[model samples]
Target: MYDALVVGAGPAGLMYSRVLAAKGFKVAVVEKNEQLAVKPCGEGISARVLKTAEIEKSDYNRFISHVIKGAVIVAPNGKEVIVKEEGEMGYVIDKKNFLRVMGEYSASTGAEIYMKEPVKELTFQKDHWLVKTRTMELEAKLLVGADGYLSFVSRTLGLEKPGERKVIPAIQYVMPNVDVHDPDMTYFFLGNDVAPKGYVWIFPKDGRLANVGIGVQGAAPKAYLDKFIKMHPEIFKKVDILEFRGAAVTIGGMLSEIVTDHAILIGEAAGQVIPLTGGGIHTSIAGGKIAAEVTAKALEEGNLSKQRLSEYKDKYNEYWGKRIKDSLKGLHAIEKLSDDELNQLAEILSPEDVVNLANGENVASVAVKLLKHPLFSIKLARALLS
Candidate 1:
């Protein structure tokens, strides 16, 4: 029997396994996928994740494809504003290599990894959890669901019922495209026809290659992406499609329940995602760290009950709870805005404040500047005030 069993060997699962094994716990991770990090994402990750994890440059360099400096916001009316990073903002990394390194590092630390194994069922007895796989069965004192948005653990446990949370359909093209103006910059496109309530993003993995994708609500994401490509002839020209992928993102913010008797949830499975920007990498990594902290202490104290494990839930609230609630207030409030209003809001954002918005540092600095516009006075007053 293992002390901990992590389902879905994604970044969150590997991160937890690594930390748990480091703390001398017997940990095992099982992943459904044969290959790692092939999940569809924009790959524009904030350096905040590295900072939160205290990863050094040399350590992070193993998988980085390119370093990002800033971003561009394209308005519905096609107006554009650029936001440059105050410091090293983030990177567009080779995600496959990053996942491989994380998995290997976790295994090297004595954590057992089993790939190509899908979790068939998770049964909680009086004391331990029985994780049944297609090939074998494993038992663990603690069970962690780091699965994707559609989590099997959450379902089996009856955590969030069907329709309790919302997810957006997303699709992307990993291709050799010539016209990303700055390899150091990412781009965001906002408009109804563009992506409806969601947004489209372009993140350069290298000078000539990029992940151009769109996330949309109430429509086909592929249709939106196709239209976006047709709109940007200059960018999509000579685009040699290397890969095509699609997935769903949980944007309902953090779930109300993340823990139960002898079980805990983290990463996307717990809905630990930012509603507005779809930026979950940093939060997912942070959630894993939080899970490890609580998991280790519970194991040490020999208290695997949910009453004791509730410390993980409480601490995560102290850390990310307010941020998620506050950000959701802003993200959901914006949904009432018309496409023209969104364009106006984008127009109101100056370069300096745009940078602040991107970093999530003192957004009030931009809000104060936004008050100067009469349109902002009418439309975004409620969102900014709250």
Candidate 2:
């Protein structure tokens, strides 16, 4: 029996395995897909993710696709607000290679990674878990479900899943040779006419290549993306679509309870994603590190009870709970706004306010800003309070 068995080879599982193995734990990771990063994603992460993943600066070029400095927010009326920071803001990565690098690094640290081995069943004995994959039966002292939104292990363990309303459909295309206005900055287009309850994003890589994507609620995501592309001829007229990808994203905040008697949930499986932006890379990396460390401590102490694993939940919440809750509130309020209201909000919000609100910071300042707006003083106040 292994010390820990992680389901899924995504960022969380790989990171968890890497950290645990580095601590001298016997860890194994099982993935359903033959490859990694097959899901559609915006592929953006803040520079802080490097520290959280414990990646070396000398090895960044192995997976870094583009170094981004900031973002451009375009209002419904096409008015633009540019957001920039003092140093490097984020990175657009070659996601497949990034996961592979992390997985290989984990393997080098003594974690066994099994790809294309979809978990078939999970049976709980008194003190350990019997995991059945297609070809073999494995046992583990601790089971971690990082299996993602449709996590089989979570369902089998009777963990609470994110509600359907909290899940959104997203689609993206990898287009090269497009007329990119600024390859250094990612662009966000916001308007109901464009994406209804969601937004359109253009994350550019080197050489004018970009991943243009859309996430929408209560509408066909591909249809909306195509319509947006067709409407923005200035950007898409001559661009060739190199790839099309789609996936379901969880926009819900973190779940209330992620630890069971002898199991733990992390990553998308635990709804640890930013609600308004549907971003999870940074959060997942941080969550994986915390979970692994907590599991390691619990193992060393010879206690695998839920109370022991709850430290992971406590630490993760201490770091991200408020931000996620605020972001979820922000999402609920913004999604209820009409295009006209969004445009008005664009007029009232500054670049700093946008950045702060997006990160679930300075929310009171945002409310104060909205209260100063003659039209939004009461209407949005009620929305925010609700």
Leading candidate by lDDT: 2
Candidate 2 structure lDDT:
0.88
TM-score of 1: 0.93
In model 1, the Cα lDDT at residue 108 comes to 82
**TM-score for each candidate, following the candidate numbering:** 0.93, 0.96
User: What C-alpha lDDT do the candidate models reach, one value each?
Assistant: 0.82, 0.88
lDDT of 2 by residue, 1-386 (tens): 89999999999999999999999999999999989998888888888888889888888999999999999999899888899998999999999988988888899999999989999989999999999997879999999999998888777877774453268899999998666688899999999889989999999986878999999999999998899888888888889899999999988787777898889999998888888899888888888989999999999998999999999999988867677777787888888888889888888889998887787766777878788777777766545554
Best by the TM-score measure? 2
Off by over 4 Å in 1: 54-56, 355-379, 384-386
Q: Locate the minimum summed-lDDT window of 10 residues in model 1.
A: 354-363
